[model samples]
Target: MANTKSAKKAVRQIARRTAINRQRRSKMRTFIRKVEEAISTGDQSAAKSALAAAEPILMRAAQKGIVHKNNASRKVSRLSSRVAALGKQA
Candidate 1:
């Protein structure tokens, strides 16, 4: 569909970028899932540690433009709060 050489190159670049971004996004979700699983099991320490690990991945995805910055911050905040509440539940 891209008749121009530049357009063809642009399509290739977009495909590459899309693949990279999709990988990053999937990785971020995996990290988030780890945190959630820890939370659901009510293991405060594990939840805390998982959240610790997930925070950076989420932020990095946002930094790389895979997700919105505020979205990342909000997820971190919510997870932090949930982990904090685990302390009181014990």
Candidate 2:
């Protein structure tokens, strides 16, 4: 219903931003899942490497506002713990 010109413009901007943010968030999820999958498979070295790769991507996501800082930190913390647990279990 965005009757105002400004309002309609905003809607278009939001749609474009949504697509970009969704892509960022999806990439973050993929990295996180890769780390988790490595952990699940009991590959300590691969898990460690995957966590390394995921960490920076996540931090970038936080900086870009695609993901909240605290949420990203929590995810990193939990993923780190899980990676550590994989080592312990081995």
Candidate 3:
């Protein structure tokens, strides 16, 4: 239990921040999933567009400390490669 007033305020702030972070994480996942879905369908142009939309969201998540910067970069790189391969295959 947070007995001190400051402690209670801190708890409230934590709850608010947690909610915001959770929303951001969920949104980021949604964007990533869109790219994955596009890739799985084997539509090169759609995958490229989806990756374009997702890239900024992923970068923003990293910038905001929701995800590690290198992790985000790796994801972007991997997805870009997969999308590029689709073009090569077609």
lDDT against the true structure, per candidate, is 0.97, 0.94, 0.96
Q: List the residue pairs that clash in candidate 3.
A: none
Tell me the TM-score of each prediction against the true structure: 0.98, 0.90, 0.98
Model 1 clash number: 0
Error (Å) of candidate 1 at residue 8 is: 0.4
Q: Rank the candidates by lDDT, best first.
A: 1, 3, 2
| Best candidate, lDDT | 1
Candidate ranking (TM-score, best to worst)? 1, 3, 2
lDDT of 2 at 16: 98
In candidate 1, the residue pairs with backbone N, CA or C atoms under 3 Å apart (3 or more residues apart, or in different chains) clash, namely: none
lDDT of 2 at 66: 86
Report clashes for each candidate as comma-separated counts. Answer: 0, 0, 0
lDDT of 2 at 30: 97
